[model samples]
Every structure is written in structure tokens, then in C-alpha cells.
Target: MTNPVLVEVVRSGFVESVHRGALVITAPDGSVRFFAGDVERPVYPRSSNKPLQAVGMLRAGLTIGDKELALGCGSHNGEPGHVEGALSMLARTGLTEDALACPPAFPLHEPSMLAVAAAGKRRAAMNCSGKHAAMLSTCAQLGWSTTDYVAANHPLQELIRATIADLTCEPIETVGVDGCGAPLFAFSLTGLARSFGRLVTAIGGPERRVADAVRAYPWQVAGTGREDTVLMRNVDGLLSKGGAEGVHSFALPDGTALALKIDDGAARARLPLLLATLRHLGIDPGDEAEALAHNVVLGGGKPVGELRVTAGLFG
Candidate 1:
């Protein structure tokens, strides 16, 4: 059982593509609400595991500021605000962008690039740089070597692996390379959800600062156009994180966890499905649901093309 959802792209009256995947929702008490396909099949958690990684950083005695905490869990858009925040984090620890291990790239938000270019900068401004920077800073704090920080054999990686295993309550049996060249682990969707649940639970138990930081600076945790930040903004006492290739996770303040993996990586369907699942679990997102349901891009405060979800898979 690979993907249970039928994904098709029919544009201009022709089916252009198709995909498959699964989604699972669970209650706070570990009861399943809805499940499709192999919900328990192991998969790479990807960037969705950032918040949980932040928990490891916290437990390692990293007293990061709210902004750093957010960066630890973020896939930031590399906007000026994001770069400034990352630089501030490095500055606080007597480090610089040169200390980061992530490859240089550009901002995820197009608007941010204009601002960054206008400032006469040479750095690529990639969003994930902040996460890499946080990793470097944590390694620095822990007396670990900055060289080979991204290597799977690094001490930091060992700590991260141990932390993830502890949170998921499942030993990692597979490892893959991530976009930033870091090692990614394979775990079931349920294991990822349970990992997040444990992270939320840990935040309340002696690691309250990590939770406080994520909640206090949700924007830095993802970016302006990211679902994690939007969901966090819309829901009270809930934290959300999105991963590459259509992976996502959300945790209720009380430890309820929801995780999803969209086989095709059609990001448009991710939030809507999550919203529907959350609603089924008694979560209300108000007007945010509209934004989640449709894409209304505004250039000059007027309507333009919209990104719509046309999936009939639920029916």
C-alpha cells in the first residue's frame, strides 16, 4: 500500500498528470480519526522534523532566543527580516554566515529578493540557511566541531538521531540525504506524529522555552507564505511545521498530533486536507480556512488568478 489518494491534474480539459499518497489524523489520546493507505509505512520526515530537532537543541542546553528558536524550526523565505534575524542569531554567538554549512541560495518569497537586492548583498539568501546556522551555533555551544556539521557521522547528527528516535519512540532503520545535504531519517507517518506529540509534551516539561519561542515567533519558524506559520497564526495553542515533498505535521498544545504525506507534492492540497481533518477534530480556523481553501494572490489589492483545489478523492 503506497499512496491511497488519487491525484490528477486536469488543465484546459485534459488530464496532464497523476499521483498517489496517504494522510492520517490522530486524536490527542492516540486514536485514529481518519487513515488512508499505508499510514504506518516508514518515510523520510524531511524538514517537517525541524521543530522536533529544536527540542533536541533545547535539551542540549541551548538557551536560544525566541528568534533563534524560530530559526531552529524554520524554513525561512530568506527575506530581509529572515536574514536579519539569522544574522542576529549568529552575532549573539560570535559567529557569521561563513560559519553556516547550508548551501547558498535565494529567498523563497519573490518580494524579499527585491528588497535584498536593493541592499547590495552578495549572499544567496536561501531560506534554509537559518536552520543550518542554528545547527552550527548549537554545535558551537556543545563544543562540537563546525566542520562536517552536516555529515551524518557528526556528533550533532548523532544527537539529532538519538533525539528523533526518543521522540518517535521508534528506532531509525534508514537514512537518506536531505536538500541541505544533512541525513534524513525514515519513520512512519504515525511515528512522526507521535514524535511531534512528544515534542509538544516535552516543551511543557522543563523545556517550556522551546514551545514559548516557537509560539512567540511563528513567522520565523517558516516564512510569510508558509502553511506552518499560517496554521500557527490561525489556531490557538497549536504548532505546525511543513516539510519538503509535501510532508507536514501539527501538534495541539495539549499534545494532539497530525501528520500527512502527499505523494505528488501538490502543496495546494496539503493545508486544505489538514484544515478539514482539524475541523473534524473540533479545531476552528475561522477565515483562515478561506485562505487555505483558495489562493488569492494580491498585487495591487485586486483579484487575479486563483489556485483552486479540485480533488474529488474525498468523495
Candidate 2:
């Protein structure tokens, strides 16, 4: 694969992180709709891989009765509503905080963590704990041990890796430790996009449950102040999932899959670039859509500065 050009940004007269990567858009029939540089290069699809992990839970005999299913696939904010839903998931399987495999901590976002602490709880406040809880429940149903479930060599990790490879139609070339310290698999942008495309098109199959869950509880997928949740909720039949660092993906109902990665791992540029790319591709996100595509800031509750991305980059 040819190396993608090193796109650079300058701030204060110094070059910064080369926010460079590729994206792929494919159709239901597996035809490429769009392609960009170095799309074949490998990447570790982080939290963006959540939906597929939920698929493994289903395959392991996890009967995720609607609500549990939604919470399982969500990268939820530790909001009261989201936590309540996650707790209900644990309740259904007669499991509790002690059963979760993910480490104990507060939500990733400060505001959400404050909200969670105000509610007088700690365990449920952990964002990925919901996913860990679902995994534990699945392990129980499968008669497997919950201990070391997050370890790379654990059966859960193996299942997750296998499932990701299966969906992406690529071999797992390497594994890395994710932010939550779980195993992360590497695959090409094309492969990642292909996996998501399949997920969206498989709306009537078993995968449909995940799609339904994300669509139904878009708010739970992320929370207030999160772009993934906002994008999904606002876009009709479009699912948005964000990974740690710079990974993000979106799939439209029309069978278009898009994936992107920012090399510098700058959280700020990700969503803005994604929103812009989707728009350039003719995906209309109507009403205040420019707010997403362009970087506009408020100073003391009033508009102040605007960050304008170059349009030529898209072409």
C-alpha cells in the first residue's frame, strides 16, 4: 500500500500532528463507493468495535432482552439514565458490580462523572463497565469464568478478535492494548469500513439487534456533549460510533460506510473532519449541519472564532 501523504497543521508557527489517514465507502454488494490514500494500511479499531463485540455476546447465548442489548453495545456516558439502564442489564442476569471485568473508575468525561458521583455511586459510573458487565453475563451463561476476561489470552478476547476479523474480512495481524486495557485488533480502513457496511446492511439479520439498539438508544451510545450520540440521533438511519484517540465510523441506511483516523490523535479535529467528509460526499445532515462541519467557538456565550477547514483536502 502506498503511504498516505503527511497532512500537516501549523499553530503558533510550528507544525503539528499530521492528521492523515484514509477512508473507504462501500455498497451492500461489496462494491467500493469511495476510496482514499493508504486505506489498506492497518489500524487498531478501538471502541468503534463495540457493536461487533455485542455480536459475540449474542453468539455466546446471551439473550439480551432489548434493554440489556442496547446497553451492551453502547459506549455510554455515565448519566443517570444510562447507568440505570446498565444496572437493569446486570439485574436481569442477577449480576452486580463485583462481576464486571473492566477496572473501576469514573466516566471519561468530567461532566458525566460529576453527574454520576452526585447520584452516589461509583461502579456504574465507569463507562465501559456496562460492556464488561454484559461480557460477564455472557460468560456466566456460557459457563465460563469471569476472571481475567479482559486478558488478551482469555476466551472473551479471543472471541472478540475472531468476531472482528470475521466481520472485517481481514486477518488479525496484531493486537494492542486499548485505553480500557482490553485487547485491540488491527485492520485496514477499508476492512473497518467494510465491516460497518455489512453491519448496516444486515438490518434484518441477527446483527439487526445491534443496529436497533444503537438507533433506539442513541443517547446511551454516548451522552450529552458527545458528538457520536448527536450525529447518530440527528442523522436518519445513520449509525455513528467513535473510538478512543482518532478513530470514528458512520454508516448510512443507503449502505454507505465511512471510516477515518487522525494521526495526531487530536480529539478536536475528529468529529469536525468527519462531519465535513460526510457532507462532501453528499450526505446531507440538515439544519445547523455547518456547525458540525466547521469549527465555530463561543466566547462568554457568544460567537467568537471560527475554524475553517480547507475544502481542497476533501477533493
Candidate 3:
């Protein structure tokens, strides 16, 4: 069955388009608070899975400070600090950016991208470099081969897969290569929300460590002006992460959690839908989040319309 429309694009009072997707919101008690579409079907959480993977890294003996840990759990915008941070992780392990497995690419941040263009594409500037560097460090520390660390059969990846299963309480349905060449595990939206909830509410251990690091170092988790950075910075006690292909996930200190994936992979639909979900849960999310929710449709370089969640989806 097809997923239902979750967002609509209005252009000058006309419904210009729609985005169909699935979402799940879990209460602190692990009950489904609200959901739309096939919450049970397995879908990739993309970079949204980073926080879970960070926990896995810790469990596997990866040693890094909280700031570095946050960077490891981020799909950063590759600003100067982000690039340097990843490099520092590599430096600690007696390695360099050349050890990274992800393909060289420009920064996700516009100004940084321009700056890096002069040096051409570099692996350190890729958004996933921090995660890759962390994975390599984990391998180096455990005496595993860094040459093929991104392989699904790599010891680090194996541990990560197991960790994801443990936190989500669901076996991975499929494994695919992610954009940055890390192994991607697919699981239900319900499972995704549950994992985030577990991370936030854990009394101790790696889960809480990961959650705390992400919340405390929001800038490292994303970067300037990014959705995850903006949301986490403005919303107290919130852990937010957005991924490739329109995947988004966040958890509150109270263990409430939400996860979603846009069917068409339109990034524009994510924040609006998330804000609407937050409002449904009676969370204000502050003015910055409200402003970011407006995915303006521009005509003649001016705002003529906007993308918004379909009315009544939350009700």
C-alpha cells in the first residue's frame, strides 16, 4: 500500500505538490503515541543512525572526547572546525585524511565549499569524514585493518550492526552501502524512534554518553544553519539528527522520540513535518524552529508560497 500525503507545497494559494512519507512518535513508556503510514516497514535512517553508531564505537573501545564523539555522530557541514576536528581524530591514531574510506567531496556548508574548491575535493572536507575517521581510529585501536574498514564484514561494522540491533530491538532487515560508504542498516520507523528514546533515557553507559555528547556539542553534530544544529541548539534537552534522503530523528530528555522519512527524499519536507509533529506533542521548539519550518517557495526571488505539513495529519 502507498504511504499517505504528509506535506503539501502551496504556491500562491494553490497546492503545487505533495510529499508522501511515514512517521512514528513513541512515548516515554515505549508505546506508540502517534504514527502515519507504514511504521513497521524497514527504511534506512541514513545519517540519522549516526548517534546509534557512536554508541557502537564506544562499546568497541573507540576512545575520543565528547566533542570528537559528537563529531563522529554527525553529518557535519564540513566547516573549518569540522574538517580540523576530523583531522585531529586521525592525528591521534597516527593517520591522516588519506586513511579515510569515504570519497573526497566538498563541504555541505556553502562558504566552506567555496573555500575548499581552491584545494580541490578532499576527503577531510566530506561531511562523513568525522565518522570515517572515528571508524578508522576504532579499527586502529582494536588492531583491525584500516584498509578495508568500510567493508560490511569489517569488525567495526559488525559491532555497529549488532549495536543497532540491540538498541532498536529489531534485527536489521537489510544492509546497504550508505552515501559515505559506511554500511547502512534498514529497520522500521518504530524501531528507529525506540532507539532514540533509549539513547535519551538510559541512566548510564554508552547510550547516555552518546546522547549527552550530541546534546552538549550540537555544533559538532551538524554545523552552522543546519536543521539538526538549529533544532538541537534551540530546543532544550533535545537530540536532533537529519540524514540523507529526508530521514530525520530526534528524542527528548523525557524519552519521547520521533522518526520520519520522506518518500521522495525531498529535504525541504523534513523540518515542516517535524515541526508539525512537535506541535502535536505540545512542544514549542522555539522561534528559530518555527522560522526554519517555513520552506518558502520563491517566485521572482521573493517568497510566494511555502511547504507545510498537510492539515489534520497530526490531529
Please give the range of 10 consecutive residues that has the lowest summed lDDT in model 3. Answer: 1-10
RMSD (Å) of each candidate, 1 decimal:
3.7, 3.2, 1.3
Candidate 3 lDDT over 44-104, as tens digits, reads 9999999999999999998889999999999999999999999999999899989998999
Give the best candidate by TM-score: 3
lDDT of 3: 0.91
- The 0-to-1 C-alpha lDDT of every candidate, in the order given, reads 0.73, 0.72, 0.91
Total clashes in model 2, counting residue pairs 3 or more apart in sequence or in different chains? 0
Candidate 1 on 203-235: residue-level lDDT in tens?
A: 354245566677778888877857777778878
What value of lDDT does candidate 2 attain over all alpha carbons? 0.72
For model 1, the local distance difference test gives 0.73
Taking all chains together, the TM-score of candidate 2 against the true structure is 0.86
